[model samples]
Target: MIAEQPKTNTAASKAMAKPLKRGRACMTCRILKIKCDGVRPICGPCRKNPKEEECEFSDGPTRSRTKVLEETVSRLEARLQELEHPDETTPSVTLHDPYSPYHDSRQLSKHPSTLLMPDSRLFTPLSPFSPTSATSSLPSGRQWTSFGLEAKSDSVTSSGSSSSPHGHHASSPFLGEEEPSFGIIQNLVDNFLPHASEFGFFLNTNRFRHATLLPLPFGHHSRPSRSLLSAVYLWGAHLSQSELLLAQEHTLMIRALQHTATDIMGPHPDAVLHTLQAEVLLAYYLFQTGRFLEAKTHAATAVSLALAAGFHKIRTSNLHPQPMIGLSSETPISLHPPHDNIEEGERINGFWTVLMLHKYLTIALEPPTSVCGTLEAPGTQIDTPWPLDITNYSEGLLHPDVRGSNTIRNFLVNIPEQGYQGQSVLAMNAKAAILFHRSAQLSGQWTPNLQPREFQSFAAVFQSLNRLIETLRHSLTPLAQLDVKNPYTRTIVLTHALTDAATIKLHSIFSYSDSSSKQHCLTSARNMLAFAGFNIQDVGYLNPIIGTLWMTACHVFIDEISRLRSMHTAWPPNTEGSEDELMERLRSGMAVLNTLSDESSLGKYQLTKIQEAFSAI
Candidate 1:
């Protein structure tokens, strides 16, 4: 056996037995002064006896821990400075202030007043149905004239001599501009009153009319403020087809802005209530005109004002502070309880109006930055009941006893409470708005890497919202059962549209991956189309936000069309009929958008986008 075995190479045996030197040591090995195999990510020594600390390597020379900490602190300090002094380091655009008298040619050039003066292209002369066409072609003799001024004078005169009893025409900047004649004011009132509620005007119409149309001393304390009147005139001019009224839109808008701002700061008896109404009207006007940022600003301002005025806690009982906190709650200095049930109703409606606008903008804008600062406040609580008809308030029908803490938060969590009227049309709209906002938040926060428990929580909330939406839709008055002549008919139809839109939004995130979600989106899209079909003639009068809902439905139809087209391509023409129905539904959606586009810039924008998407396919 010894003779058969080949002599081993002594050099190779020594080479194999010698340990190779590692180029670097992992942090763990280096800290322990142990030999390392230098494996990347996880070194062999660390892997063999793994601990909670992860293995890491430094290509350069190792630094002291204190030095590393110092560098990190310096970086954080620099970042904090950047954040604290952003205006100094970053160039920013200042929003145009309509209230400022310093607006000059240079200022106008820097920031054009798109909110008041729309794009000329959007109001082309060639388009017969263009929003500006009626105003643009006014007869030479017909003109909007200022109080105590000649029709030929375009400039606003600051004359102290005026017939108004309050001297409002002389002292108030709101009335300093051109004032419509009595006949023109009446005409505008006629034009705006029918659609007032549609735009969140909660004042009693007859009271508003009587107060505003009176000779001089607008006697009642509840009379509309100069600012509120100006806002009403602005909306009236905006909605009017009269050449004279339309010509005054810009002047009325300027006056409204100035008046509303002044009224908020002034000591008017009903400043809070009137200013809230003015702000809401201005916000809706801006939104319809496609000035979304301005709309959001005004809406947020309304919400702030509402909160400050305690509008959210209307009819709420002052609760005693819990003993655990060891502090007594201060008795809120309540404003004299609303003068009457009508006034109380206005407060309730006002809170919901602003809340709806806030929620809608939260979903519609979906700003990249956090909205916690603007859209909400700490301990922001709402206990206001749902709104009822102004007539209901007049008849002494008020919301029953409140049974819940946070009306909205409780609804979101599906917490059952007694005596809450959740079935009213206005209440349903508010609920839909909440669902719309929550759906956006949920879909935005979703990620594939979410933990199982986190995902379960998300899914639970999503399902709960879905159930709520379904419940809301089922609880609504059937379209067939609604009185066509009743003004509330439009509201019912719109609420139905809103619920379907909410469903689409909630399911949109899972549309591609989940079959059930895709079906839900399609069904909702179809339902919205049906709603529009029934209300085609009145589509122009629906809330401008409905344009956004139309666009939402259009998205679902577009996706389905694209999917069907792809299937047809992949399967050799057999899927041709599959997309026909979807294309028709898409066209119906576009038709409603087109009807709205005549007056609303938002609608025009949505129509343009849908057209582009369809063309791409």
Candidate 2:
């Protein structure tokens, strides 16, 4: 009577010990077996708690589901055939090999003969002093080549390429691209697109940028040469990491193929080896997700390959910020040396393409701000440069001379010294990568006396990214918004333009670090939202991009709000605490954006997207 006995359930206990059925799905989706819907992490069920770790799914029904569905569909078709034609029938399709892109028409991505040369073209310096496109003789636009493309034909007839359309960057980046077929470029992009939605979105976002998975510019069928060349071709597009990763990945493979092709055929040695650096980044990302061994493998591979091929010279700020070396980085890298010193790095142009690569490697292996200060100041005779932001390039970053900060405003100037226009742009991209990732590390600093080193680098990177945008914009023919006439809608081209615009909206980054202090940064953010809000009143589809900016802006705004709250909490006796007004000022200023009457369709779309994203934030 005092206690009742509970019944034991052996059935459930036994089930716990039994192996759960493994599922079929893509490597990424299968890893998180929860319910792939074929897309995995991005799929509906998996997305419920993006912050939570997704379940590994490769083992059970998930793995075989695609085949099962295909089989069922085939049987239904056969039954229908029996009811109609009766005699004719075929079994369901079967995957041939164990690779992602099965049955893709283009197979030989890289051959020893064609890709022999290390990636010398990827990080050479570009001309840095060119005037902005708004003021230049030309109208700058997107260039896939800078994205690192290497198509079979330097001159594919526009008519021949009509099967796939492409958008021309506003700038005439190519030597003689009068008017490439828009359809062909679209086809190329569509076919070479790499699927990398795993990391967060947007390569340039103020969030954890290092975690972002960059998109490829091509569809699945494209070969390596196409991707390498497309890097430059896509250069003017201003794509984010996800937007550019595929092309970048393709570049590595293509360079590899080119080198391999050379060994088999002869030694063209295409001289493109920066792909090793790209792999290191991907490995770092994987490492972040808890794949340490894989990361080590890639880092080691990149280091060895880089050294073996003399590709170590390709080091730039973004791809491998710190190669694990310290101040005396001159030690020869025999095999993809992980920590080459920056001091030993060679310099070129107003830019430091290969030089920055050393920094990139160092950063990846080590932590931030510990580069032994490899970044060099210009010679005494050379004047110092000013700081810059995305939309206001000429205003802050450069001296009237523009050489002090090593900001390469134009692509041509660095060509002779670096030997590859493509390599230099990538180096710049690497620097931007560092700055972008480091910026987010800035937790809200309330009374900021001296800005944190991370913030300083962020500001510095923003300046560089702005300079790049200015250079690309200046190359366009007449400064028109991108107008790609392709079926895939050629999102990369539009996204590239949008990414740049997004960068411009990030004026919020410099808030706490400035001389005016956190107060000034808060004021600046509130002011930006007001106009940015109006920009949305102009469009809808653009709402997605706007959302990215809005969320980032909110992070800063919210930080300031919290700062005010802290001030109220810690106000000294003489220090008056009528902080409600400060709060009202910011909240009310933020309100102005929503009230903007002239919001464009793109603006509204971006705003809405951002709002949904922050539904949690």
Candidate 3:
């Protein structure tokens, strides 16, 4: 055979060399500098290197599902981090322990998997979002259900203004004081509850930024309370953004919340209630991160909190109709009309209304309205019309007293109707109007058209989001007298961040829709920063949002650096050559997305959705 074996066939020769074929390697393999069969973007070579001849596929038997999930989650987190916080100068910290003084008092806790008690306050100041009348007689309207479905419920009339349910803590601006402690739960009753320490956990900065952005007003209380030492430690560990990192951290959070909810947080009513809210918020962030099931779990927990607060056993404030999250029997929530200050009571009512609306949106089923053995039949069926309602939730911004809260109508009233800021609002409104009008024009249905008059009820919510944006814009320009870096609360700034992020998401629909009025949408988006106090054209994260949001996981990091810089008193860099920079950033982001527009990946799929969606425009 050695002397004269016929030459091997070309096919055999080719087959022998096939395993050595060179192709683009997996991102990991390329970076690791290992010999990759250059698998054609995830091929045999990529899966099992030729030299190693080792098939790494777990499909062969005995592979652990938990390990796969953990690895999958880790990869996602790393990618998200890479997309979000690219810079290292500033970072956000998560509050692992409520007592840790290292964090700001306003930001108390955010343990992703660990559930904490909701702000005890959401309970007592009972102000349900139901109509002021005992019965709403208006025609039933279309409303968006929590699951994003359209449904109608009977509208029940609300009764007269109910008195504050918490007579115990009445008349006090705030009770004497809360005891200070570290690494343990501080009980409000006669005893100290050390249980909170059981669920305490911290997240790195990259992980923290992946969570939801707090709107203004809420941000005042949220940001400071969250600045803890452990939080700082976690944040400082990683300055740059990494998608793989964010996904992994988020996985950590989900696991933590899941663990806390099942084992540590839910046995007690009060703890369960708070944990519900925390879980809900965390879930909301996960949804934003494209993690649906985890988001659903958190949302369900939040609803469960509402169910507990509305338990037939507890008394509720008539003014606040929604289920209270963490009201405790030991310390009843303080809900009372101040003899000298009706305004404060109203403010509390406003807060309750917001909470209730949140509840209504998060969980489809509304809790039965029962307060203090006062067995009133739970409010009307959702489909019933309640036009005679005393308060229009959608119009939350219009109230004159919103001076205390950042409701919608309050902010829009002062827009110099014809000026640039006003112009932005007008354009936004016009675009919105066009959206509804066009929907009506095409399908001959008014309102969101997704539902008849029901979505109209959401007009208020839309208005509120718009107001949120306006307040954020105004907040951007600190009084020339106040320190720009350390303006008090910066409630406006935070609100702007949250609302801006939200609007970007909301309008992403338009990016894909062919619009006779895209200029309006794009312009309004640009003006978002102006409303908050920046040219927007110059801001790094906010600037690129115009086009990057739909493509390249860019949505995650857009405002991270600016937020960190602002939170820490560091000056955020000014964008040089504003227009040029914006255009360039847009180009890079758009190019990545366009490349993906033809390719396949989670990030690419999302952008393609935007592109295809806008084709109608």
Per-candidate TM-scores read 0.69, 0.29, 0.31
Give the per-residue lDDT of model 1 (tens digit) for 365-473. Answer: 6652332323345676666666766777787656445433577767877776554366667777777777766666667777788999999998898889899889878
* Model 2 stretches astray by more than 4 angstroms: 1-186, 190-268, 271-515, 527-552, 563-617
For residue 592, give model 2's deviation from the true position in Å. Answer: 16
- In model 2, the worst 10-residue window by lDDT is 195-204
Model 3: how far residue 126 lies from native, Å: 43
Instruction: Give the per-residue lDDT digits (tens) of candidate 3, residues 1-617.
Output: 55887877999777656654332344445456665554342545456544433333333355445447878999777766755765732334432663233232223323323325333222222111211232211111111111111111121113211112212221111111111121111111111011111111111222222221222111122221211211221221111143222222322232234333542122332243234334544543344334545555655554444344443222221233544344445644432332322222222222222233233223212222211111112541121111111122233332323222122222334333212222222223222322222221222222234565567654554554455444544534342233334312232232233344444433433433434223334444443333334322222121111223233123322332233334564332445323333444434444545543331222344565544533422
Which candidate, 1 or 2, has the higher lDDT?
A: 1
Candidate-wise lDDT, in order: 0.68, 0.33, 0.31
Worst 10 contiguous positions by lDDT, candidate 3 = 189-198
lDDT of model 2 at position 221: 19
For candidate 3, the per-residue lDDT at 492 reads 29
Of the two candidates 1 and 2, the one with more favorable TM-score, higher being better, is 1
In angstroms, the error of model 2 at 433 is 6.9
What's the distance in Å from true for residue 411, model 3? 11
